[model samples]
Target: HVTLVPSHPSYAVISENKRQVRYQAPIHQPLVKVKYFYGVLGSPSITSGKHYWEVDVSNKRDWILGVCVSLKCNEKWNFLRPENYQPKNGYWVIGLRYANNYCASQDAVKYSDFQDSSRSTPSAPWVVPLFMTIFPNRVGVFLDCEACTVSFFDVTNNGFLIYKFSNCHFSYPVFPYFSPMTCELPMTLCSPSS
Candidate 1:
């Protein structure tokens, strides 16, 4: 996904030769100290099979879709904070915050026990809100590294299966991550029809 992320340096208004990105509001950047601004687009790492992708987010309002663990193997965590968007330091996301508030993030993982694997202690980032009635204009991300899970879908409401980040603790090689959260529309990345 065109990686050039120096700790996301506020995404530099998102353009490293453009794959259609527009949505600013996190400017004022000049090396690290950013408190709350989002941008990360990473791909190519998967580690297994059963992969799928889609994202049009029609009339988008804020976005983020799952799978992480790449900044060349977690650069010692601190990818510019959202508390480190997490599933034990390697994120497995799901977002659409502040426009309708369809949230799901719980850094380092823990919140009613993110699927309860004997509640293996680790906490600090929790945003869980997801109570959808189906309003996903297009989003179908499914990664199953031998069933360690990372599923999110609504692909315009018929493929609805919106919240699922179960028991995932992949120790390296995980990709496909995005965050189009400021809005000028067009967070397009659709390639899943075959």
Candidate 2:
């Protein structure tokens, strides 16, 4: 029996050094959430710098997966920012990580293992306040890492929205950056995600 549960998020499992992954669901089923599991390819040479990581969405049929509306970084050790500020169209958020090369050093790893009994939850912001509002329906969130910068832009055109953040708080070694970056406008202002 195949049942859809709201608690179960869809996952995309990717291998190291792979550029693309695909997910196919029954034409009748609808997917609401997406999760990804990936491992960065390690380089033996100390000088091999990091590479920009990107995830792109492709539509196969009339069934469409909407643009990424929300993002959350998975809190894990060796995790870079898992989430990123949302991009509007065809663009990707790139250049996010601490170590310059694979052989240099590993990013700080958090969360002992999935089952470590002695686990510590990182502290949250002191204010616990809401973020700023950029568009009527969507809000823009930024992260500032001294090591790298993340930029987003429209895929159709070259127009870019460059966001800079400094001293951003991230607990994971590799931040699983998620983006809840979406627009409020329906027909005119925004194009369909598919």
Maximum-TM-score candidate: 1
Best-matching candidate per lDDT: 1
Q: Candidate 1, residues 25-107: lDDT per residue as tens digits?
A: 54555544435535555555668867887767777777766777774344333234576677776788878866688887866
lDDT of 2 by residue, 63-167 (tens): 111112112322331122233222321112332221111010112234664558588733221111112222112112222234433333323323324233223
Against the true structure, candidate 2 reaches a TM-score of 0.27
Deviation (Å) of 66 in candidate 2: 16
Q: What is the lDDT of candidate 2?
A: 0.24
lDDT of 1: 0.66
Q: List the residue pairs that clash in candidate 1.
A: 107-125
In the order shown, what is each candidate's alpha-carbon RMSD? 16.1, 15.1
Off by over 4 Å in 1: 1-24, 27-58, 61-66, 71-138, 147-154, 160-176, 181-194
